[model samples]
Every structure is written in C-alpha cells, then in structure tokens.
Target chain A: MAHTPFERIWDRHVVKDYGDGRSLVFIDRHFLQEATSGRAFDRLRAENLPVRRPDLTVGTIDHSISTLPGRTLHSFAAGVARNVAMHKNCADFGVRLFSIDSPHHGIVHVAGPNLGFAIPGSTYVCGDSHTASCGGVGAWAWGIGTSEVMQVLATQSLILRKPRTMRATFNGRLSKGVYAKDMILALIGRYGIEAGVGHTVQYAGPAISALSVEGRMTVANMSIEFGARGGLVGADDTTFEYLHGRELAPKGAEWDRAVADWRRLYDLGDAMFDREIEIDCSTLGPQVSWGTTPQDVIGVNETIPDPSSIADPTRKAMTERAIDYVGLTPGTPIAGTPIDVAFIGSCTNGRLSDLEAAAAIAKGRKVAPHVKALVVPGAAHVKAAAEAAGLDKIFIEAGFEWREAGCSMCVAAGGDIVPPGQRSMSTSNRNFEGRQGPGSRTHLASPAMVAAAAIAGCIADVRTMMH
Target chain B: MEKFTVLTGVAAPIAMPNISTDLIAPSHFPGKKPEEAIVMSFKDKLFANLRYFPDGTPKPDFVLDSPRYQGARILLTGENFGCGSSRETAVWSLQEAGIACVIAPSFGDIFHDNSFQNGFLPLRVPADDIDRLTKGLARTNASELTVDLEKRELRVSGMAPIAFDLPDNRRIPLMEGLDQLRFMLRSADDIAAYENRASTERPWSFAAAGG
Candidate 1:
C-alpha cells in the first residue's frame, strides 16, 4: 500500500483498534517533566498502577526549574516542592530521572534527542506540547494532557484518534539570514494558525532538507502553535548522521539494521496527503510576530497591518485586539519597535546551532544599554558544549547574561519573567497574550534576529548586522 | 468525572479569536503549592488577566465579569479557542469557573483532546451557526442555552434547535463518566501480545536507557 510516513509509523504501533477511529497505539519512548507529571504520578499512586515500561520512560525537571547559575532544586522556592515531587515519583516508580545535578538534565525535548532517546521511525509521547521537536529526527511524536499522560504511564500506550495528514512542502532555498524559524513563522502567518488543526503536518521539499536536525527541531517545536499535534520531516542521511553515535542510539549491527529500516520509512511515490501547501522559502524573510498570535506576523521590514483593511470581520476583530494588546501602531514598521528585553532560548531555538548563530551576531557588539538580554541553553550538555567552544565568552562579552539550561522565560513558571507592559524580542515559540508573563508583550523571532534586536535595542533585521 | 448529559445555563459571548489557554489560565502564580498549581483551585485565576486588572479588581467591561453574565455556564466564542500550549490547567480553569461547554468554530487539537478527557464538552459548529447564535443572543432578552449531549442538539431562546456532531466514542465516555484508564486496562492482553512481536521487529526502540 502506498502510504505517507505518518501512516506507516502509525500502522506499526496499533496494539488494538476499537474501529471507531480510536486505537491503542504503543509508545516507544515517554518523556515526563515536573509541571504536568505531578498529577499523573499522583493518580497512578491512587490507582496503584505500576509503570508498564520503566526503561522506556525518562523524567526531567525543566518546566519550573530555575535556570540560575549554581542553582539547586531549592533555588526557585515555588518550584522546589514540584521538583521534590518529581524526584520522589520517579524514584518510587523506577523511572530514570535526570535531576538538577545530572548533566543530562535539560528541557525534555532537547534532552530526548541529545540523549538519542528519540529514535527514528518510533513513537514518542511527552506531557509537554513541544514533544513534536522529536519529530525533527523523524519520530512520530506528539504531546498529551495529564490524563493521557496517566494512560501512557500505566500501559505504555494511548487511545489516540488517528489525525488526518497534511504536507507542507517548503520549496526553494532560504536566503541568507533567513532560517527554519522564519520558514515556519512565515507558513503560520500565511496559512493562519488553525490551518493544521486535526492533522499531522509533514514538512518536506528542498528548504526542509537544507535544514540541520536542530533547525528542523525549531520548525517542528512550533507545530502546536499552528494547532497541529505533530510535525515531522522524513529520515534521510542527515538524520542518520545526527543520530549515529548518540548516547542511547542503537549501536554497531543494530545501528546498521535500524538505519536500513528507517531508510524505508519515507512516503511512497503514490502517497497522497489529505491537505497540501507549498511555501517558497526563497522569498521569505526573517519573520517576527508583531501581535499576540503567531499568525499575526510580518517580515522584519514589513509594517504592522491595519485591522480595517482586513476583509473578514472575525480576523479584523482579532487583528484589532492583537494590535491593542501588543501596543503597536498600524503603519509603523516592525523593525524599529523598541524592545525592553531580548530572550534567546526555548525548546524552539535553544540548541548548539542556535547558540552559534546568535554568537555570530554578538561577536563584538555590545547589547544596547536599555535592553536586558539573556541566553539560556536548552540543555546542560548544550551549555557545556557552548562554554567549551567559547560561545559563552562571545555572549557574556556582548553583555548578555549566559545562564544555565532550562525553559526559562519562555514560560514564566520558574520566576524568570518579562515585566508587565514591557516588550521583548524572544526566540520562544508562542506569543499569546501574557505568555511570557501577565501583561508581558512578546515578539517572536529567530535567534539571530533576537541577537540583532539586543544589539540595536529593538526588533532589527539580522542581515543588516551580518555584514 | 462528572457525567454531562444536558446542561442548560446562561451563555456568554467572547467574540475574540484565538482565546489561548494562556489567557484562560495564566502561568504566573507565585507561591502556589505544587499540587494546587497542577490540578485544582484555579477559579479565581480563570481568565485572570482578562477578567481582572493588575490591582486585583475585576474588569467590569469583560464579558465574564459583567453582571449580566455572572455564573454563565456556556461560552460562545470565535474560532481557535484554547489554542497554544498543551496545558490541561486551561480545561481545569474553565471547569472551575462553572463552564460546562465551549462552543467554537474550531479549537486547538490538544485542548480539544484534553476537554474530552476531563468530561468537558468542546462543541464545534459551523461559523455561520456561530454567527446565528451570536446574533440570536443579541436580539433576545434571554441568553440561556441548552446543550443536549444525548440528542446532539443545542437549544437557544427564540431560535430553532441547532444540530451538532460529536463522535460516539467521545460522547459515550463523557455521558457515562467513564474513566479512560480503566477502559484501557482491559486491553492489557492485546498490548502484551503486540509488545512480544515488537520486541524482535524493532529492538532499537526498546534499547536500554543511557546506552
């Protein structure tokens, strides 16, 4: 049968089909974090359910853990009890947890791939939405709620309704200073946020193939922002090269056999998607969200869109509200909009390559005096590697605060937050109202764009600074 | 879980698009207990940023805060409601605020799944139907709406009942207040058999952690 990669992976994992669009799909890997896992663990204890496959499940403390240097579990007082609970729960359940002191400790999405746990052609489930980041390596991955988390914990499976398939082909090559972030932001901006709802998006074509695995992770990480449960690129030599010798990846003969099998995991020649969209990346610019929604985005040089010009009343109203929330004038260009903060990390853009790109821009320039710029690595290993390569020196010398790894201000649950009414240029995925903090306004951009903004003290084009 | 067969209550209109889970339940609660932060007691924080000012005073202009919409049990809003983030806390907040159902043209995929797991109904109707309901509420003196899950129809004052579509699999669980975990446990034997086959078929998937 000619099938898409999604259908191929999904067909292999069906444990039982209820014949009503619901199937008990076996999960290959499960990643858990503190914020959403506490309740799931508590429920498991209440029901006296044992973790079916403890070896396949891994836990970490990222969501609420403070990214402060020399930090302990007690550093963030509010997060302390949750971190404690995670440790206790993982210990009691025989699940391996990367605690605060573990070098493996980091954001679940980042650590999963770094540790080689997100194997190609396998099924991955996590409690956090960005678990789709694993799909960068060609895994079938998606996020689940705490109740679904309990389902995975007790049985190593989930009762999932098969989602329709959509293919987003990014044709042509991205111009210089444009990146995977811009490619994805441009797609969401062009297609509206709900375009991928009820579907798993497969990112293909020349531009997607050009992206490094880390860059593809940045693209896949934001799939949820567009209402897609999962997004992925098919495995190729690039993917195999990235996963070849990682910590938990299959070794020697197993590796050869796994690669041989993964090579056959792509869509068949006659495969057809339920929906298809093509994005020409050659003309795409470094995109920045001018308003609250990711869909309310414009190129760095573009002006804010006026709501009155919109034809659809609902979209017009949404534009008006977004503009009001973001405090932007309709005719003003997005480039010169002053920012009070610059954040350069999240599961979206917090990787070694992301750091390298930001460092290239921050090499000799100082951050603007009015801006408080921060660079939080996605994982401890990423932090260690960056420091080893002197990327930390480039950032610190540029007046950016180089911090430990975790989901810092991307989600303000860890007490790291942008203040009320302050505008920030961020590399994180979402720009929803109060997403960074209550009344905090955010402009989503690429890591290079954020670094350029930090230097210029506003949302500026990275190409201008590249030279 | 509470079984919801029929819910008849005041329906409030929030016409804004993309009412994100972050707006429904803000993430900036300081000094909250871990369990409290994760699962329960978020009624006051429901739409905290939109419903109240930074001074902790209610925003009277907000529909949820207005006197007419007090104790509203149904929310009629724009498309893509509960978009962004896979936080189940958003569902908990709406449930705590006495909202039994949310009628929208569309929803965030994760939020939709989360709603069903909690036995909360997330109704999807055509955009035209939403417009008719929005207009019907504006022209009428009464704003009460009746959602009959068993019959798959929505009844509003002075308007013909609108038929809705919900998959039987989702509807039956919510109506029966069935726990999904117990239901999944029944397939343990099937899962075990599948695992036995998968062990040889995909050995790399079960590679020991930290290998």
Candidate 2:
C-alpha cells in the first residue's frame, strides 16, 4: 500500500526505531525564542551538552522580545538585560537568531509560517504553547517543556511517546459571529477540559474543510487545552492557496509538484483511529470561558453554571472553586460580572485579522475609564500590517495601550497583565486561576469581544456593540 | 551524572481532557518554593471539574471521580485530551497525582512529549479501546493499565498492544532512568564528538580548536 505524503514525511524524519513501539524522530526544523531558550540552553551548558545539529535548528526572539517592525534591538537598555542575554546566548550556542529588525521578524508562530520555515507534513516543535498553530499547514507541531527545550536545544530531535489516534469530526456551516474559536469552545463545553486525554486528534468534517489555514491553526493551537498530542487536518486547496507565494512555500514547478504531493496526504479509508468524536458547527454560539479551564466554558448567551445543579462532588468542588476565585456566585450568571481590563493578543488570535476585527469595534468608541485596554500584535508582520491599516491608531485613540509584539499578557508576562482581583476579557488561550496575573481573574473570549469589553469596561456582547 | 530510579505502577484512571497546568499547580499567590500541596498528590484537586460528555447531561462513568474505576492506573479518555497551552503543571499534576500511565485516544502534542520527559507513561490506545475501557469501568469496574518503561509497552489487558512514538536517543534514558538533563550530562562523550565535528564542519562555530 502506498502511504500518503504525510507518512512519507514521517518516514524521512524517523532516525531510529526503538523496540516496543517507540522511534527516534529527527526534527528537521526547530524553533525557539528568548524567553525559554535563554534559560534552557544555560542549563544545557551547565550539563556540558553541545548542540548536535545546529544546521537543523533555528532560533529567534519571540516570547520575551518586541515586535516593533524595523526597530533595531538595542543590546543595552534598562530592564532589557533578558533580551540582551538571549542574543548573547544564541551567539554562544551557534544558533542563528532572527532579531527584531529582520523582515522575517514576527511572533514565533507567525514568523515560522511567514518565512516558509514550516513546510507541509513536517514535524515542527517550538518552546511555546501555541506551536500547534503549525498544523494549519499540515505540519505536526506542538509545544515542549523547558527541560525538553534543553533536549531539543542540545539535539534537534526530541524523544516522544507515540500518541493514540483520534478523529474529531465537526460537520455543518458556521453561523455568523461564531468563528473557529466558537467551534472549539463549543467542543470544550460539550466535552469539558479532560475529554480528549491521551490522543492525537485529526479534525475532519465539512466545517473543518471550509476553514482557512489560519482558522485551522486557531483550532490546532488549542489542542493542548483539550489535551491532545497534535491536532491535524488533511491537506487540501486551502492549504495550497495559503502556501502559494508564501515566503518559504516552494515556487513555480516545485510548487506544482509540492501541491501534487500534498494533494495525496490523507488517511486510508480503512485506517482506524484510537478514538472518534463528531460535532456540528451550525449550532455553535460565541464561546467564552467562564471558569479557569478552557473546557469550563459556555456560549456567550448562556449563564454561568450553578454548582448546586451539579450534584457530583468533584465537579461541584471544581465549579465552586472557580466561582469563588472569579468572585461570582454560580446561580448569579457570569454575564453581568464586570470586567476591568481587555487584552487582544497572543499566538492565538494575534494575527492581522484579529487586530483588524478589534480595531473595527474600537473605532468611534471610547474604552471605559476604569478599564485598562491593550492591543498587542502577535508579530512584527502583524504589527506592520496593523500600522499600514491604521488599526493601531484606532486602538490608541480608543484608549488601548498599543504596544510591541510578544507573548505578553497571554502568559501574564512583561507587564501586559490584569490587576489582582480584577476580571479581564482576553483573546488568548487558557483562563486558569492566576494565569493572567496573581489573583487576577480572566475570561477568555474572541478578539472582537475583547475590543467590545475594552470599550464598555465589561463583558458586553460584541455584536450588540457593533452599531 | 546521577541515575534516577523508574517507579513503575498500575495506571489509575483520571480521564478528562483540557487538563491545563493550573490544575497541576495553580499559578497561586505562592511561588515555586516548596509547599505542602505542590509536594503532595494533585490527582483529586487536578481532576476537579472532570466530567463525562458535558452536553448538559450526566454520564456517571468518569475515571478519576468514579468509585468503580478507583485505583485503576490507566485512564482512558477521548481524543485531543490535554490540549491547550504548553504548561508543565499538567504533567507534574498527573505524574505526582498517581497516574503512572494515561491511556487515551489522543493527547495534547506538547503534553505528550512533556509526559515522556517527566518519566510518566502517556499511552495512546485505540478509540474503540477507550470506549471499551469506559464501558468496562462501568461494568466490571476494572480498568487496569500497566506501563513498563523498561519494556516501553503499555498493557491494558483487553486492549491490543499499542506502540509509543519515542525518539531512539530518548528511549535509552527513559528505560534507563535518564531524563533530558541527565542524558545531556551522561553523554559527555557524545557532546565531545559533536563539538569536535563542529570545529571542522562549521569552523565559525568555534573560536579556536583549543582555547
């Protein structure tokens, strides 16, 4: 039987096959940033481990560095030692660094794809949570721990345990205001956070088919929140169209050949998966995370769940804890709870479209006086696009703190944070307790909603605020 | 290099998805300094909101919260389990919480790698097997999972022998109790080999042959 191109890529990367169903996967493309690599590589040096394959790996400043397009990264500055240290560290490790001024500069997620470093059917790994975003291009990508960060740093390959296969199929057309974010959030609400543990899920269905490469990334980026090794989609025209003219995408005759090859990437008809889940996107509403976990969520129109309605002690305890931490009673609805801050940025939903969507709502509207609003672009490319479109001026005019790109508030780093005890509307993944900042409650929403909240200073319906 | 012992055991099921790092160790007010809860098992606390098929209906068949599935080491769950941001708290929470092996149809890509690195067995079982385990948990109340890190095979009794995708270089340490940090430290000879190769293959990489 002939294997698909995906399998071919898989076979090529298989460096060593261990008995008992394990194999050594040699990573061809390795991506890293200052925030994690700085510390991880330092540890590798402490252990005296020299990098095995410098040619196979690529390093850049993403998580902790800025996305100010065209700005030279000054090595000397106050409170910029970490950034300086990262440059020096990458130099010491012989890793090629894509610094701030590089046209290729952007968020790690955006930079990889924009530069065509992320190719079809390749295994991509990054030192960030949203690395699954690469799955948009048919690449198997995921995040790695700090220690594993050191491992990949020393050697381009990572030791991985094979994952069980699962097929999560969602069929149906999406309603307006309900994007890919809503589809995933609906799955979370239906399944909860722990529904898909120990599985490598392949998203297949009519709805998943209609999604763009960007949208597919939005879903794959959150696979970790669902607890899967990697989320993937079969290659199709959308994958090809996005790759066309892409910085790293093959060109001319090579592009035609690559497309022909990518067209054949699919699972066998008789191929069996470890698990299967099916969902319908037609009924999905705007999703919002009311509790700490992504799965502890509800549709925007729905009210916060009452823990008493849940008789299970374990679930009840979890709900109660979330309610207490979020300072809302279960019976009292999450809709009315006020928001103090609104953030729109992160590897997820920090693209040009997300910025534009937020900017549209920010225009002609003033952010509430009490609210601290921020619009952090995902990458330098996104920042440049937003600036060209004048979206930054809209955000800044509407009282949002327009700043440089980086992970920023998504992980509650570099001062893009929610104040203690304040609830924030964020356009990033994860809403765990203190995930944004110590004692700072977070409510996960779409970029549109983040803009609406920034204007209203509370969780107002983005659609309602549009007019 | 120090050798770490592999502690093998039966996989207790605490099946649920979207197990983020916060559930493992909440980004609480306290810092990373040693604390009682961090040192203690985080299973119960970690599986706080774990529910089965949350379509506003109840399915009393969950691994961590179920009485019948109690003490069963293997946790069977749906696909995309452990999806979301890359937070090691999820790994620490499960590893410390007493789940030696997590058997699911899928796993969060990053968390899957994190699990192997941390010395816990995160197994991938067929979807049918996952459903079967869930049913078995409800029927005979048995869902035993055995993970032999040395053998690198997960035995779920009724389920077929499933393969794990691990790197060859990583397999040695995992089976021999060498983690990433330890592997780097122990392979002093290998590091030297690469360094010596680097001097010639990419002369700019090294300032001088001997400095």
Candidate 3:
C-alpha cells in the first residue's frame, strides 16, 4: 500500500510505535544555535552524557551572532556570553562547529540546506522555531525546546505525538510581482493564525510545484508563524535539480537510488488529509502586514482594515490594538505608510533567489536618503554566490549595506534594531509589536517590496516599480 | 521540576490573541550586558515592556501593572498564546513571576511543550469557557480559579468545573515531575534495539557527515 508523503516519512523514522498515538521517532539531523543550545549543552554535561551522534549534529553561531564586519565575541557586549558558551560547548561536545569565521556559518536553517545536510525523507530538529525550513527538501523538521534538545543530543530520538495532516493547496499561477512570500502572507491573512495548529501541513498543488526549492523554503520557514509544527513540499524534479550537485548530496549510483526513493515519497492523487484548504494564487498580489500579527495583512494596494469591517470581535479588538501600536489610521492605504528602514534578510527571504529579486528592483536605483537599508545574506555561501554574481555591487550602488551572514535585524537579539517610533519594511517572517525594537513598528513584506520601499522611503507597491 | 497536582490562584485575563514570547519576555533589553543574560533570571524580565517603560518606570495601563491582578498566579489568554520564537525564557519568566498556570484556547506547539518541560501548566480550555472566565474575572472584585491536573478540570466561582484534555504521555511527566530524558532512559534496552534496526533499514539517513 502506498502512503502519503508525510506518512511515509513518519513511518520510516518511527523507532518504536506502541500501537498508540505516541512514537519514538528517529532524528536524522540535529541543528543548534547559540541562544537556546547553551542550556541544553549544560544539562548534558551535568548528566555526564556524550552526544549520541555528534557526526549528525552541527552547531552554528547565529541568533545573537553579529553580522557586522570584523565582529569578535567581545564586539557585541550583550551577546558575547552565549557566543562564548556556544563555541565552548560545541568544542567540548565534538559536534561540527560552524564558527563565525567558517564559510559554512549563517542562520542554522539556511546553512543546513545550503550544505546539503537537510536531505529529503528524514526527520530533523533544532532548538529554533524556524527549523521547518528544512521541510523544503521534503524532510520532516520542526522546533523543540531545550529539554527536547537535551533528549535528542543524548539519545538520537524523541517522543512525539502524532500530528494530524493538513494540506494547503495553492491552485493557480502567482502574478508577476506576487511571490511565495505574498502567497503565504495571503494564506495566513485569509485563514486565522491558528488555522494550522496541531497539524503538519503539506504544501501541494500546481502553485507549490511551480515554486523553486528556495521559494519553498521561504514558505516552510514561516510555517511556524502560521501555527504549523512543520510544513513540507513533496520532492520533485525541481527539488532534485537543486540538490544534485550539493556538497553532502549523494553521488553517482547513490544519487539515482536516492531520486528513485524520493519519487516514491510523493503523495498519491487520492491520498487523504485530515483537513485541506485551497487558495487561488492567480488573483493574489504582493501582500504586506498592516497590523501586528502576520494574519493582519492586506494587498499592497489595499487600505488598512477598519475594526468595524472585521466581524469577529476578538479580531476587531486585536486590529484596534494593533492599529494603535502601529500608529495607522483606519482606511489608510498601506502603500503610503512612512518607513525609516528597509531590511532584506532573514531565514524567510534571505536565499539566493530573494537576493536576485531585490537586486533586480534595485539596479541603478538609490535608496531614499531617509531610509537605512540593509541586505544580509542567509549564509556565507549565499554571500559568496551573490558577490560572484555582482549582486553585492548592485545593492551597494543602490545605497543598501551589504553585510555578513547572520540572523541580523530580524530580531532585537542580534543588536541591529530599528529605532523606537520608526517604521521598517522588512523581509523577515514576523511583525509582532516592538519585535524590531522598543516601540519599533515593523511591516512584513517581500524583498522586492522592501527594496521598493527603500527607494521610495515609505511603503511602495512593487508592481509599479517592476519593469 | 516541581510536580503540580493542583494550583489555585487569582487569575488575570490578558485576553489578546497571539501574545508572543517576545512580549512575554523580550529578547532585547537596552544596554543589557552579555554576562547579565546569565545572571538575570527570567523573573527579572517578565513582561519587561508591559511591566516597565524604557526608563524602568511602571506602565499604569498594562494588565500586569494593575492593582487588581497583583500577584495573580494564573493567566487567561486568547488563541495562539505564545506564538513566536522558541525562547524557553518566556516559560521561565512566567514561572519566575509567580505564574504557575496558563489557560488559553490554543498555544504555539513549542511553547506548549516548553511549559510542560518546565513544570508549568498550560491548559487548553474551550473558547467559550475562556470567554466566560475572562468576563467573570472582570465582573468580580476578587476572583480565584483552580486548575486540577489529576481530574483535568478548571473550577471557577459560580461556574461548572470545565474539563480539558491532556494526552497521557504529557500528563504522566507533569504528574510525576520527571524530566523527559529521565523518563525515556527507563526503556534504554528498547531504544538500543530500535537504533540497531534503524541503522540496518535506513543507512542513508545517518550519513550526515558525507564519508
């Protein structure tokens, strides 16, 4: 009997199933970052246990790591402790450490796939919530707390409650300016934020198949923000093409065998899902978050939603609160909202394709004098690749700062923050109030939208700037 | 981890949906030292922005700042509470601030799991029940609530003890106050056997280093 893609991966990874809902699932790969791993490593040492599989684990300096040039551990006064702890712990445990100096170092979610560690048809985890980005390669990946991290580091397996499957099908072609970011933001906006909770979502259909593997990662990276534990797209020729020459990918006959196995993992047309939702991407435009949560979004041309227009009382109250925090009036068009900064990076939209898109819009254009624009690559390889492609020159010429790879400005933990009372158009996954800084307002958008906003010095429609 | 059989406290209603970890305990504090991160317990940073302003002055309008809910040990919240980032510090902060139980309609999966790991109770009550409790707490001057884990019920004044669901595996840990690692180690032999079989069945998945 054939199995759905999600079930096939789960069945293969289950070490012990008690004929019940819980199972001890085998973890194929484990990734860690500085902020959360320190405590887990401390717990393991306190218990006097060696890592069960060091070779399968990789540690990187992200989250609190600095993206500033010539950054040392001491350069960031507030981030140095975890930075030092992470280096010491990785060295002590024998896990492959991607130090700040290493070309492999970047955001764990991005570096894992770039180096081919996040392979197809396996279970992976990290102590960071965006670990779902690994699902782009058809891997079953999700976040865990430090306690679960300690368990996996010591035993190579975790007890998991079986998640109900929810498949989100995007059924039509995305418009010219509309991107994977827009599609995902639109989905979260249309459905409530908790729509995908307690479920592992399989993103399938013509639109998903059309997305490049990098595009799929952007969708999966934000799956947590949409309330899914994980989100995956079935492996296809597009996925195979992306992984064919990757560093840790299989070689020769092994590659052929792997492809054959991956092909079989695709869901059968009649495969069942506990719940299914379909979105028509054909009409979707470039979306922007007008309020605090990702779900409080509208198209670039649409006006801010009035509280009265929202029928759900809870949502109405939330909208009112968010508008007060964001300092926006009801019915104001989102396109003209003033912004002081534009950031083009994060695990969400920091991939090569994202850079290319932003660079295309930025060619021969300069950022407005009032906007502080930045472009931090997702990984060192991405930085090197972009430089080789001269995307760096394009961005610099456009007045955007081209920086080293790290989780910079996406959160305040990184020390690169948008100032208080200032608005920012960012390519990051979240738009929570004060998320960028104290009293800092954030609007989530695609990289192109960010670049366009940088040029215009406020929120601007990318469609108008394109071509 | 302290085993929690029952918890009775004055409940405060923070009825907004999607209250993220960043809000519960902010990741960034102005001019905070790197060494300070290790020394500052989550309790010091609990609702940093809401409880205090930039100059460290208390914010009067915030729920945690109100006199009525002072020392309130239970938080009643709306849907998708604890929605962003896997910061365990949020759980630690709530626990440190004397909040032992968090009742909501639903939660972000990681946050829910983290709460259990830290011996904090995060119960998922029905939306209507949550609404009733939030309104009831506001209506009454002194409102106390009780959460009984053994019976999986929430009791409030002038209302029925609303029943909630918890998987046996999750419940067992909280009831026994056992860390997940300690509990899993009880079946070491089975784990080893499963590993041996997994190595034989799926060798490719183990090849992370690329020999």
A421: Cα error in model 3, Å: 1.3
Highest TM-score, which number? Answer: 1
Per-residue CA lDDT of candidate 1, range A1-467, in tens?
A: 46899999999999999999899999999999998999999999999989999989999999877787888888887787888999999999999998778899899999999898998888998998889999999998899899989899999999998999999999999999999999999999999899989899999999999999999999999889878989998999999999999888999999999999998887447789999999999899899999898887889999999888899877788888889988999988888889999999999999999999999999999999999999999999999999999999999999999998899999875767888789999999989887887778999999999999999998898999887
lDDT of 1 at A283: 92
Model 3 RMSD vs true structure = 1.9
lDDT of 3 by residue, A1-467 (tens): 34578888888787777655778888889998888888899999999999988878988987776788777766677778888888899889888888788888889999998888888888889998899998998888898888889999998888888888988999999989889999889889988678878889999889989999999998888888889979998888988888887877777777787788888878456788889998999989999998889898898999988898999888789889999888999988888888999999999999999999999999999999999999999988899999999999999999999998888888865668888778999999888876887677899999999999999998999989887
- Better model by DockQ: candidate 2 vs candidate 3: 3
Model 1 ranges off by over 4 Å: B29-40, B139-142
- Native contacts retained, all candidates in order: 0.66, 0.30, 0.55
lDDT of 1 by residue, B29-95 (tens): 3334333444446787788778765445667788987777889999998889999888898998899
Per-model TM-score, in order, reads: 0.97, 0.74, 0.96
TM-score of 2: 0.74
Worst 10 residues of 3 chain B by lDDT: B29-38
User: What's the DockQ for every one of the candidates?
Assistant: 0.60, 0.16, 0.59
State each model's CA lDDT, in order.
Answer: 0.89, 0.67, 0.86
